[model samples]
Target: MLPAEFDYAAPASLDEALALLAGGTNIRILAGGQSLLPTLKLRLDRPDLVVDLRKVPELSYIREEDGEIAIGALTTYADLVASDLIDSGVARCLAEAAASVGDLQVRNLGTIGGSLSHADPAADIPAAALALDASLVARSEEGDRTISAGDFFHGLWATALKPSELLREIRFRMPANGGGAYEKLRQAASGFALVGAAAVAEMDGGTIEAMRVALTGVSSGPFRLHALEDRLVGETLSEELVREACDKAGEAIESPLSDAHASAEYRVAMAGVTARRAILRAAGQWR
Candidate 1:
């Protein structure tokens, strides 16, 4: 496949990227190029300008500051997986999701920011982000703004990011050490999640005090299962109760996506199955 001819500029700084973005329409921002490059090669898009942010060093960091883990948008999945800053339950869930994307090479090349900005409903990172209640920081010529993970995804292959905005960083509150895990059924060919689930919990003896369950690949976007969390929280779990909550994982979606690899009914059913295993893994109830 051949791409349409387009003007390209690799910006050295965030300010330069912002100026390029604000200056015109049809100017696409390029992060890792894992998604956009494929779109371009397939002739799915024809943009007049491509602003590359690969050289912007400031946008590649993983650190703990304030009350959250500050992750620059350019922080690669490999970086997140290898970072010591990924210590807590929420961060561990994110690391597991990052590790699950593609293979080793893809993890090395794919940026967390790029992955989230692409907003593919099947991608694993979004479920982790949503489960951990992460916030995305965007920079534009106008100013900076923070978007909650719940508000960030507009729909399939869509996000709240405007054309003029560059995703700067992602931050999530540091969860105290407890338990976290991500589980998914992957599409063999693309390695995209057929249905992905992430769970983060704060445990008190045999009880869960705080918990979050999020899912991807089953709907138009990733989402938290608040009702399921409500049912699990503050309860001393029995296998029966955990099994019941996992059955409701599909309830996170208003509508499930049916694609060539999976039917919506199959995905919805897998949603409950996978989430059950994921929650069990997080709670140390199952191996």
Candidate 2:
């Protein structure tokens, strides 16, 4: 289906983009357009103007500063996969997730910020960001605010971003002596996750010092299994302990969504399985 007619503007600067957004109530920012274009074509959204961020050169770089990684809003999934500065474990996990997003073409065109802003429950980045304890930087006419990944996602297809605001960058403290992994049950057709898990573990003398486990596709939004993390912290990393952590994670999810690909019960079960696998992989048990 064809989208409704709309005015398009590819702003060369952030201020111009902001001006376009501030000028109208119905304006959509086009980053990667992987998600937005489809929604527009389906007529799920009708915007008076489309503010293309692609030409905003400032929003497309990755840099490391003060022991944290900063990714600009326009950074593509493929860019994240190719960055050598990111930890090997985290990069592998992100690359795997990015590669699974639709296909190579989608990965090359899909922006990290676009995916997060879309807030698709089954998308891998939200869960991965949660596990990494990432923060989002959003800018608007009023000012800028940094929101934790946990608070950034409000619900299914929802986010903390105000209509007038644009997400600038995503920042997170790089882990030390820790590794991470993302595991997902993919839909054969779309390659989107049916149930996905991202796990990060910090080991001190072979004992867990800190741990984070997050899940997607099982709930309305990506969420960290804090209860399970608490149980794992200070415990030795082992198959048995990982199993227990995964079980706790499965039990912690209050509600799981049932979709065409999988039932709620199946998602819950897969969440546990994926969580266990991801944690083990992060812990270097499975390499």
Candidate 3:
């Protein structure tokens, strides 16, 4: 299927892009077009203008600043996977998730911001970002506002972003004394996750100090299992404990979706299995 006819503009500067968006009511910003083009082709979305951000130089860099890592909104998954600045456990998990999105071609063309903005419950980045405690910086005619990953995702295919706002960058505190991993079950054809888990753990003197667990593909949005986090912290990091924690985490999730590929019960079971595996991998329990 072909996308509907629409005006296209590749803006070289942020101001130009912002102005283009502000000038039109039915305008969609195109980052890599990996997600948008398909939606457009399917006629799920129709815009009067497609504002391309590929020519915006400043929105494509990855850098470390202060105590956090800052990734530009337009940075591709391939760029994240190849970046040297991303060295910590959180970074590794995020990079792995990026690599796992679709395929090599999609990774090279898909932007992190695009993935987040699309807000697909099955997308890996939102869960990974939640585990990393990432924050999004959005800009608009009014000003800039920072949104935590927890608050950024509102519901199925929905986000906190206003029509006039543009995502500028993502920021997250660097992980230390910890490691992370993301585990997912993918659809054989599309490679999108049917169920995914992202885990981060910090160890202090053989005891778990801090941990985060997030799940995707089973809910309206990526969600963190805080009840499970509380149970795991201050406990000895062991297979038994991890298994129990995973079970509790699965139980804590409110109503996961039952789709054609998997039932709600199956997704919940897979969520527990993946959570345990991810936690073990992040804790170096797997060799």
lDDT of 1: 0.87
1-287 per-residue lDDT for model 2 (tens digits): 99999999999999888888888788899999999999999999999999999999999988889988888999999898888765464545555566568888999999999999999988999988899888999998777899999899999899999999999999877666778888989989988889898888778877988888889888889999898888889998899988876775677777788878998888888888999999888877876
**TM-scores for every predicted model:** 0.95, 0.96, 0.96
lDDT by residue for model 3 over 23-141, one digit each (tens)?
A: 86898989988889999999999999999999999899898899689999999999988986664666667887887899989999999999999999999999889988899999887
Measured with C-alpha atoms, the lDDT of residue 192 in candidate 3 is 83
True-structure lDDT of candidate 2: 0.86
Model 1 over residues 122-239: C-alpha lDDT tens digits?
A: 9999998888888999999999999999899988889999989989999988756467789999999878999999988778888988888888988888888899989999999677
Output candidate 2 Cα RMSD. 1.3
Clashes of each: 0, 0, 0
Worst 10 residues of 1 by lDDT: 84-93
Counting only residues 3 or more apart in sequence or on different chains, how many pairs clash (N, Cα, C under 3 Å) in candidate 1? 0
Candidates in order have lDDT scores of: 0.87, 0.86, 0.87
Cα error, residue 161 of model 1, in Å, equals: 1.0
Residue 4 lDDT in candidate 1: 96
Clashing pairs in 3: none
- Assess candidate 1 and give its TM-score to the true structure: 0.95
lDDT of 2 at 245: 67
